[model samples]
Target: MQVIATAGHVDHGKSSLVTALTGMQPDRWEEERRRGLTIDLGFAWTTLPGGRTVAVVDVPGHERFVGNMLAGVGSVPAALVVVAADDGWSAQTAEHVAVLDALGVRDALLVVTKSDLADPAPVLADVRARLAETSLGDVPGVAASSRTGDGVPAVAAALEELLAGLPAPDTTAPVRLWVDRTFTIRGAGTVVTGTLAAGTVRTGDRLALAGRDVVVRGLQSLGQPVEAARATARVALNLRGVAVEDISRGDALLTPDAFRSTGELDVVLVHPAQRLPAELVVHVGSATVAARVRPLDDATVRLRLGGPLPLRVGDRLLLRDPGTRTVHGADVADVDPPELRRRGAARVRAADLTAGWDADADLARRQVVLRSEFVAMGWPVPSGATEVGRWLLAPGLADELAARVPAVVARYRQLRPLEPGPPTAVLRSALELPDAELVAGLVRPPLALRDGRVVATDSGLPEPVQRAVTGVLARLAVEPFAAPDTEALAAAGLGPRELAAAVRDGQLVRIADGVVLAPGVEDRARRALAAVPQPFTLSQARQAWGTSRRVAVPLAEWLDARGVTERLPDATRRLR
Candidate 1:
């Protein structure tokens, strides 16, 4: 599928030309229908003679609605840049091209609309000259009059040919569909419709909605329901249980764990769009987000984005000034995280950060990100931050450390019932690591430390309950294979939260109602039953072992069925 945005000056006949070619009006709202101008954003698509369809997004051309135009045009891989043949390039002409170039839309065709009203030569010549100054210098041009319908068909054919010649979009990349419109249906629940700019969406898929998750209940291709839609296709999604207000234009629906959010950004600072010395807005995907610019010494600065966008390395953002409304630059570097930071100059730069932590491997990467932001502000990247480098850790190790911390603390609580956790040094010794490196592996910016122990901010368990859970395990270890009654747990001097936490962590196994055993008791019972001569009966076994029937009956019966013992049809039992 191929998608294109129509970008141009206001009232330059962009909407009329779209209607002439598609036979479907781009305007949908009643006000727009009456106003006869493309207000907000209108969408339509067309099928060429070879039977290939191309989706067209009509962006608002007025100066005031430039932001709307930006949101509409931001994701399109190509564009139809409209200029008025009679009036030549309007105020927005330069701005539109600026945004397109900034967004890296090199594959575009210029449309000189309203051709019948005036002489075409002078206007076409001016557009030709303007095109030379843009990344669209080699872009094709076509003239059309919505009124006379003189060159509309030819324009369509030209667009289809251009689309046919372009390379296919990379669909295998992680999907990020920035929503431009969201609404609700009576039976369908919430429906979000948009052009999928960079990825694919399929039915029954779970998509992370910025901060939460929503399931894809259904989908539509053009107006027909379908299974999947890839990049450069218009899509409407029926999402199950997600409310309409949970998303809006510029919200990215992406795969969880695939996109990371950061307030900091790295960007290349150059353009055929404009000579930008002033700060500008950065629009990426469908989000009309803005970031202020200060030139870094090495052509990179940390950007504080307006929203939690799913950006990664090599992701391109369209830059424009919300105030002056011009596209400033094209293509930015992705430092490490996707975060928003200072608007102008910083004390740290990427160069300085690399200089400091390059040897420690773990600390080196973190210091680069932290110190870069600091240097951009022109502030000293603090010694405290540098000290943090001593504790900086690899992400995989940190994750492993995070996963083990709760259980570790739980074990600590067990071994020292009075002292919930031993010193960090003891923990290091237990894990067989030097105290310093272990602390470093479990401590750092992304990880946290409290009460002298490292904890994962993302790990949901709290400390007090973790201690209680530990206490339960300690008590259980002392009295293995014994059934601990509910009241007995209450009697163990364990809090309700601690008791619950113990169960949650599998510290004690609840075998039946009010019949809980120590963690490994069930396995021990099964093993012992396997060695028994016969399940003649619990009473018979008690007599043989000289122990109590209370200990033998359930254990023998459980083991008898576990293939540890065989029960005869007469209800007697023997080891298998």
Candidate 2:
């Protein structure tokens, strides 16, 4: 499906032309029909000769309602520029052409109406010459008379040929449907109509409207009920969770999270003759808001919007001075722009925008950037770009992290030698790195990961602590399970700190609190318990170990916990 809006001066027979082609009245209100002028937007659709359906949005061409006109055509991809044979070109016609040019609308059809009343050759020649200078240059033109229906078939044929060349809408892109009309039906609840510019909308899909989610209870394309609707079609959505009063003409139904609303933008102006005024009315999509402009250079400026708009890069906005009635065009360069803090910051930013993304330069300015955002801006990652998960960092940043790890681990060991080295999470926080993968990649060579902690490969106990560990192990070897208590171990300089270090180094195994054993003692105990009967008593197990109850009891319980034995109801133990 295709949508084409009418652009011309008032009383130029735009509505009449639509009514003649589609056989349906474009005027909806009684006041508009009585006044013989289209005060608000009107809609009508027709089947072309090639069986292709096209919808027409008839916009009021008066100067006072240019805002309404912009709302109707801001999202429409193609248009039919209407001019009258008798009037030739007028002020509103020129304004409309300027708006289309500002919107970057290149696909159009020039329709000269009232051809039966006046010879359209001169008017067609004049309109063609004028449009040749603007963005709608060298477009196809047709002479039609809506009253007598002469040459109307030629207009239809021209539209069919134009629609043939139009590209299919991108369904993969995010949906941004600008609401041009909203109302309530008797059984359908709230119905909002607009051109589905991109993406697809289905019956159960949820969309964001005015920061709130609303379910699509139903959908219609060109007045036919449908379960889903695709782009470039005139869509009427039956919204479930909103009221008629909650939505207005300018509110948009967008794919949630895919778009962001902002009140500020960085843009590249189109043929900016002079510095823009301090205040201007900016039109984007279907919404218009007053904004303040700050010039960055001859062709760049920063605009602060009066309200938030879901804008994206490459979107063309029409800037109009409400006071002076001047129109200018601009293309959005950046949505989330950086703040200019110091003097000459704007110039530097302008240079960045103009130079595009240079990995070296951007890394020097912005140390890190989210990989998703970087790619969305159409930047190519330089060769050897350092990426840590979703974060893209500078090469220098990785080198810096690698360089800081050793010192960090050394300080942590000096502070707490008994404990394992600093945890991966702690190291990440201390270095202010954003990702754990970055820390993991940086811990290399002389650094290694032990358990969950990062440590130097040579990290160990001091000379005195090492001697104490060796002495403690020798004593445990004599009586493996009959290990020394906390007091006896502390007396031998193997205190809690030294014991913990030994356990971490695999020199000792801690069976229970204050109970340390040599590494091979648990295996010997398991072997001894296996030789007993199927179910044996605790006294028998203690006798087998040849130790006192204090040491024997904990060791037996530790074996039970390790699944080597199970305690019976009568206080006997059995091998599993």
Candidate 3:
């Protein structure tokens, strides 16, 4: 697991404890060493008694640099919450605890350092009282003084127990890593270091670095290369092509299909101080995004953002207000973003926390339909749990519906094989589905859509009509050499409507009034009209064909539609 920095007030000896334990000075920069305060996140590692090694992130303790502290603690799961043995619970301490709680840090080991410098009794009491208000209050605190190494081993032991007991962060969950640090090296491309917030990262995986595809050329933990990493592991990834100038302190590295970039989101903003957000800045993990708050309740609010960001439907992120022009606000919970909203307001109530998945079958079905629409259009899925719990389509039934719909329609058509098929009500009666349901699901084109009446794409003409159309076209291929006649269609044993339906099915084409043709009839009609050798008058035309105008009109029109003969204004037909 990846380790992150501790939280507490200044001079709490977080750095001192880290130095005494890991024997590596956490103050890296020259100014920080002289100032004797950890102005940034300090990184170090130590081996526990259980033979498992762990990494530690020492966050800044000063209130002024809380944004940096949040950045340090963003990706870590279990934290080492430090408090001075003498000063007890300070203001920064409370804020740090709040940050930890908001970030959803589940497992943490408490450490009350500087036991020798001050009386431990009253301070420990205050510490416990302070812990009572947060998720980590139940966690045991180890008292230690970095100077004499007193209780250092005890603290290490407690940490080992905490590590062993630490709940394994869900690797199967969608991945989100907040980029805390971005730098470049001589040989490698841009290397971004951060904690793996959730899910797993493997070699050759393509991740959306700050919502853009960034190649993972390599991964490192505690300054050494590794193949794969899981949640809560502090890692430095050698990116393939992106540059350092493109990214900075507060960008997130996300799994492409696993997460979505959203400008609008639903959030539960908590101003533990009860201070409302006027125009506060939101910090999630290491990256801070600017957003405007629309509060629903004391604990819940909606954060509308200023830029595009990758946030999964169920994932959590921290929020903050920029204390300084270059800083962030206090942390808040990412309760899931509001539904896509444009030019309108949505109300999120207190019950919204347990309410996102509050969907029934009908609602879930709608959600699934909407989700399917999204998927078909190539959009991100909300979540499977959300789908199962609150989607408009429930129980993976949409997929089942997608498969069942086509099959049911296909089978229905098979059993009723007839010309023009059945009407909407008839097919729906056969399927026993509502009109709306059938229309939305099965009857919508290109699968099934109604033009004049309902028609399934898979529906075909009746067998006899198909055979009749075939024989008519075959006969016309020899003598008439034109399209089949509508009046003579009875010659092939089918009615005009059935013949028309066959023409619609591509068996024939209706060229003009009372005239129809099979495929390639136009070319044959031209040859026949040419062989007639002369423009015959009405009588000669009728006599030559051994038929009256009733048969001749339809036949002549068939030839006319095929451009074989032009009927003159004086009733004399001519070869064209």
lDDT (Cα, 0-100) at 51 in candidate 2: 99
Instruction: Give the lDDT of residue 352 in candidate 2.
Output: 76
- TM-score of structure candidate 1: 0.63
How far in Å is the alpha carbon of 28 misplaced in model 2? 2.0
lDDT tens per residue, model 2, 1-576: 899899999989999999998998988999999998888999999998889899999999999989989988898989899999989899999999999988888889999999988999999999999999888788899999999999899999999998887778898777889998999999889999999988999999999998999999999998899998888889999999999999998889988776768889888887765667888999876788999989888778899999998877777899998776678888887777889999999998878777763545555555677766655443456565688777778667778778888888888888987776889888889888776656776787778987988976776777788888788788777767677888888887887778888898787898888888889886788788778876888788887777778788888899889888888888888888
lDDT of 2 at 339: 92
Best by TM-score: 2
What lDDT tens digits, residue by residue, belong to model 1 across residues 1-576? Answer: 788899888778888888888888898899888877667888888897768898899999878788788888777778888888878887778778877776667788878888888877778778878877777777778888999999888898889888987778777666778888989989888998888765688998898886888999999978999998887689999997578887788887877656766566666555433245445677777786656555454444556665556666456776666656555554444435323277532435545433432224323344333333333222333333332243333335455554665666667756644343446776576655433445554544534555565444444335665554566667657655555556765675554555544554456565444455567765665555555555566656555544445545665666655676677888787766
Where does model 3 exceed 4 Å of error?
269-275, 321-500, 503-576
Q: Evaluate residue 230 in candidate 1 and report its C-alpha lDDT on the 0 to 100 scale.
A: 82
lDDT of 3 by residue, 246-313 (tens): 98887777666555566765554433335565666666667666788776556556677887666544
lDDT of 3: 0.67
TM-scores for candidates 1 onward, in order:
0.63, 0.90, 0.68
Q: Which ten residues in a row have the lowest lDDT in candidate 3?
A: 326-335
Assess candidate 1 and give its lDDT. 0.67
